[model samples]
Target chain A: MSTVLLDGTEQLINGLMYGCFYALIGGGFTLLFGVLRRFNLAYGSTIMAGAYAGLIPVYLFNAPVLVLFVTTIVVSVLVGLLVEFCCFRFLRKGHELAPLMTTIGMLIVIDETIVYLTDAVGLKYPAPFGDESLALGPFLIRPDYLAILVVSVVSFSAIFYLLYRTRFGRAMRAVAERPDAAQILGVSVRHVNVLTFVLTSALAGIIGFFAAVSVGSARPEMAAWLTGKGLVVMVLGGLGSFPGAIVGGLALGVLEFEAVWFLGSSYRDILAFAILFLVLIVRPGGLLGTRTA
Target chain B: MEYYVAIGSIIGIHAMLGLSVYLVAISGQMSFGQQGFFALGAYLAGLSTALWGLHLLPALVLGVVVAAAVGLLVGFPALRVRGLYLAIATFGFGEIVRLAFLNVRYTRRIGDRVVGPNASEGFRHVRYIYDRGITPLEYLGIILLALVVVVILFYFLERSKLGAKLRAVEEDEVAASMIGINVTRVKVFGFTVAAGVAGLAGGLFIHYSSYIDHDMVALPLAIASVTYPIFGGLGSFVGPLLGAVALVGLTESLRTLHGAREFIYGALIILTMLFRPRGIVDEALVLRVKGWLPLRAARRPAPAP
Candidate 1:
């Protein structure tokens, strides 16, 4: 009994640590959805593009970790801007699925371009911190996991500050609430939309760098998988809720770890989608979301 | 000869899938889980013929019925959400079904060989057509027959009163309800029929390939199934058929391009959406074609929705 309790506690801590990553990714997705009322299926692919771009300097010049991080954010911002221009900017006010379908097209293009360049092979990614673990009372925690938790929390706080404590954030929220009214009030909906994309893409870049570090490899296929997980996390928390994304991601991480412990690795993804299905059924607006439509 | 025949069969099967998407799409519910119904139909139909030693027609019927029944069960809970929520919910449903199949490992010994789904290793040796010595041409004919029957059903449905109700719900649910359109019933009915048609497509697909796998019905298939209707035209049932043929034909032609095929395909979809957002077979195109034929009264086309 004591051993089981120890394992459960360890799992809980580890799950919360992993949940930070999902929170970061899901937060980016929710931000985009909140501002535009549309999903950029290419969001993960844009991040993947940034990661791969960062990898080039590492491969050719063996750049330091900071250079790689900087490169990733720069490239991610550019790719995010391009996606907004092609998929969202002009296609706005068209059919409901127009932007979605266009993003999917962009996703395929980005993923396939990466595959073509890299021959669809995974590349080794260096972790910022060395591979070491800290033992904390019957638990072994990796240093990188700690780093991820810190970075994710700080990032989340930064986003909260930007959203709530700034003039731009107010404009963003106004646009999200009512685009026409915001336009009438001279919010420049286009600027808010572009800026929102930039913010989320930068967040995605940071998350991607951390993900590549923890996994110790970068692959093109990660885009679609990340997109799926981000969507699941976004819906599980609430469609357009920010805080909800954090709570939902953390809960999913914990539940996923428990699933892996009780069942097996094979059942991990199943558990995620099963919970999502149930949440959508019982609470259509999500755990922290108010009912809409 | 055999290659073209096989391509034709695939196009027919995809057309069936596209039509299923069209049915659900016209009702205003954007489902990303029709592939779930397809997987169910494929597995169930394959099992009936391979494991139970049933005939092809009966196996296909069993597949359609089971998928349609599950669709009805799914439709109620699914009806609670709208727009992106509905799309994500259906997407979750699709992932659940796919993952479930990934873990399922049901097999039995038939004669001297093992058959049935073997988890991620995939279900193989579903050789009902091969065992019967059916040729590729004959299989293609079978698929075309199935497609024809489905098209006929869609043709009749397009002219029926329920079709109007379905479109009415798509336009505005509140107004539709106020007009006594029974919005819930129309949406659920559309969902059920779409699942059934997807099941039929899967039944034919497994027979042709002589294999079934969870990965085969994953996200790509779901995306392609929906893309066909949207790409071809959403104006009428004929749109998906045309879309399926054109897009699949493009895919087959681009097979020789190696790495460039997918890149070009993606670019083309983007370009098409930019140029013709309503798809290749919108109301304008239909009207223009009608004008070419003699004795047709020219009615002004409805502006693109």
Candidate 2:
């Protein structure tokens, strides 16, 4: 194979790797949009919160890298519940725009809190892969990325299982499909909302760990961009559809990576957003979204 | 004082941006792309002066027109989306515009010397009018004049039939359309005008500082624009103006706290949402204040609560 072909193949694999992570993150965003029917802007903060949660065990307890995953999940779930109670529950009866404004406020507060707690500076994530890679005939794939891909795929499958095979999944879907009807059927809407948020946020924790590790550092400022990427993935896939999020995320990941590779690196975000803007224009429902009307 | 004059001008410029958001607020849409329009206007004004030697007024007007044109294009499809989806779509447009500018390279002449605008460096020597020795006070006067005109326009718009139609759409889109008001037309028009005003503000901002850059119009700026109308009260012409003044003042006053400033600012927003979701100034409050002023129109009997 020529050098260009090899580079192209490498870029495709890199994009796919990123797509796996984006899918994991986008699932959490879609879950909130699905169950609550609002953009939980705090989702970004939760990702950051996951990173900072690891800060405690690593710094205070001098814990090994193994502690990071547990801390991330635990903290994300707590933050998820906190957001549910403080930002979401109160505004349920308010105007349509109320939740948006309030959530934005919540995002700022959470961001600031992280900033205050940590210096809000970048910290290196402890990668466990140790620079290992498996070389194929023409391409070398990093085990780190493959690990993340495996983890993402497994997590997504687990989510599907939880959503499809479990009793909790039925109750969660029941709430999403018909909240009042679900309530009449003896499912507590509040419990379902909180529980579903916890599940989704736990996924965010895993995404957070992998993202910071892959990118080499975690910074509080990454929240907005992460949120935007998640939104791009969520909308591009079709809102409220996990399967669609995975497909859209993979496509978006490749599109963004190739945009930087072919065009200048700065053009990556522009291309992603341009596609998102076009998607909103051409098919508001997204690639895999069912036509509403 | 030059310092006070500069601060006041910044407040005025921000007020114009706030009003841009306000226009869309009344039309019942949540748009977060005014910063993109502002950047567009700033670049246009900056480029016209640097490259083509256009005067201030024409450049500003041109910027406004172009921004409005882009707004129409972006809003044509975006107006079909509502609430959160619309906000995200506008945000996507905003990021696209900002990134496009960041990637665009500009070469220009500055007093017999050639300079290039880099990826993030933006354009300098923007205020050719200022280079001709327009004093800060004079520039502030120009901005104040423009603001007064915009405010007066908003005031009249509040009382106008079309304004009522826009408000009607905000209150309920289906009902407005059922009553024969063209909802799509109204929304697109409001978005276009709003973007034009933001572009006008962008022109003012770059010229005032003699610089233009892409970073100045990012996501945070868009969020700030949204905050203005919501914090001040969305019901009246004064809402965005008041919100802008108060928030800008708060921000400036908290400058002493340094890093804590953003935290405090965020806290204030959360507190405001908690305590005053209706905002600091609503219809009743405006009415009461007007009642105390003793103007003829203000002297009308209070309606029964």
Candidate 3:
């Protein structure tokens, strides 16, 4: 009974840590959908790009955590801009499926590029974070987990401040709410779009970096799950809901961890989406979304 | 010659998949789950023939039936969600199905040998057709015949009430319902039939390749399936066929370029979307091309009645 109790507590803490990270990733996806009203099919590929970029400094120059974070953010922003120009900008808005197709094309391109760069192999992180764990009584939290929690909290809080507390944020919200009206009112909708893409891509980059840490390596080929989970999170939280994204992301992480706890880990991926599918049927608008026309 | 036959057969299978995607699009829905149906068909057919010594024809039909049924099941709830939600839900469905198949344990026997699905090791020795010694050319002929049959069937379907109903729903679902067209039914029917077509393709694919696995239907394949219809222009059935042929041809030709195939696909897609947002073979473009044909020129009304 005591062992089970200890295991449950440990799972809870670890799940919370991961939940926060998932929230960040999900938040980024929801942010894009909120601002752009289009799904970034290349979201996962950009996350992979960020993860790969994060590793370059560590492997070649033995850069510190700060360098990795900065590099990932910058790289992700660039990729986001590229996607916006190459896939999204030229697309005719409100077209049935043009944007989606273009994004998928971008995803294929990025996936192939990463595979070519890495020779279809996984790249190990210089900072493995496997050897260190913070112990408190009967629970042991890995350093990476702790870092992920802190980063998630800090970034989300900053995002909250940005989205809710700033003039630029208000401008962004106005554009998202009514792009034409905002444009009429002299809000440079384009500026907000660019800013939103950069900010969300940076957040996705952070989440991607943590994802690589959790996986113990930067795997270009195996990075599709980040996008899948992000999609699951975005939908669960509500397509254009930020707070919902955070909650959905955390919920997905905890749910997935609990699934691993109850069922075997081998089938956890299957159960994760299966559960989300049921949720989608039950709550089509998600926990926080308004029904889209 | 064998290599050419194999390539032709693969192209035919992809064309079928592309058509399946095209069907769903005609009914105002998008599905990235055709790959899931494809996987289901392949595995089910493989199991039927390998385990019970069923004939390939029956196995293919049965597999298609199962795929269509699953499509209806997935499409029913999925229909409630719109656009992005539907796409994601179907995607989730595909991943779940793939993972479920991957974790299963199933087996069948050959002459003094047993083979089956082996967790991550994949399903092996699906050699029923190959073992029967049907040549690749014969296989190619068989698939092409099926494609022709499907084309003819749909050609009639387009003139039928069901196709008109589907087109109505695609134009406007509320208006379609208002006009007593049964929008949900049409949408579900489109998805179901599309899945059946995808399943038939999957059955053909496994018999051609003579192997099966969970990863056989994956993200790239699913996305490629979706892209074909869009790339070919989803205005009509021929668009997907044209798109599949051109895209698959491009993919094959680019195979020799190390690390450049996907980049080229990406670049082409981007350029196509920019220049030909309607795809390379939209109705307008087709009419234009047809006007230049020798037969159309020859039948030019002779400047009199």
On DockQ, the candidate that comes out on top is 3
Please give, as one word, the docking class of candidate 2: medium
Model 2 CA deviation exceeding 4 Å by range: A1-6, A116-120, A291-293, B111-116, B283-305
Model 2 lDDT, residue A95, Cα: 57
Cα-based RMSD of candidate 1: 2.9
Off by over 4 Å in 1: B287-305
Q: Candidate 1 residues B24-75, lDDT tens each?
A: 8888878899899988999999999999999999999999999999899999
Q: Of the candidates shown, which would achieve the greatest TM-score relative to the real structure? A: 1
lDDT of 1 by residue, A1-293 (tens): 59778888888888999999899889999999999988889999988999888898888998999999999999999999999988887773758877777888898888889999999999999977889888998898888888989999899999899999999999999998999999999999999999999999999789889878889999877898888889988998898899999999999989998888878899899889888888888888898998564
> Given candidate 1, what's the lDDT at residue A130?
87
User: DockQ values for all predictions?
Assistant: 0.69, 0.53, 0.71
lDDT of 1 at B277: 78
The models' CA-based lDDT, in order, is 0.89, 0.84, 0.84
What are the clashing pairs of model 2? Answer: none
* Comparing 1 and 3 on TM-score, the stronger one: 1
Question: Which DockQ value does candidate 1 get?
Answer: 0.69
Off by over 4 Å in 3: A128-130, B283-305
Cα lDDT of model 3 by residue, A138-222, tens digit: 7888888888888888998998999899999999899889999999999998788888888988886887788887877888765
Residue B191 lDDT in model 3?
90
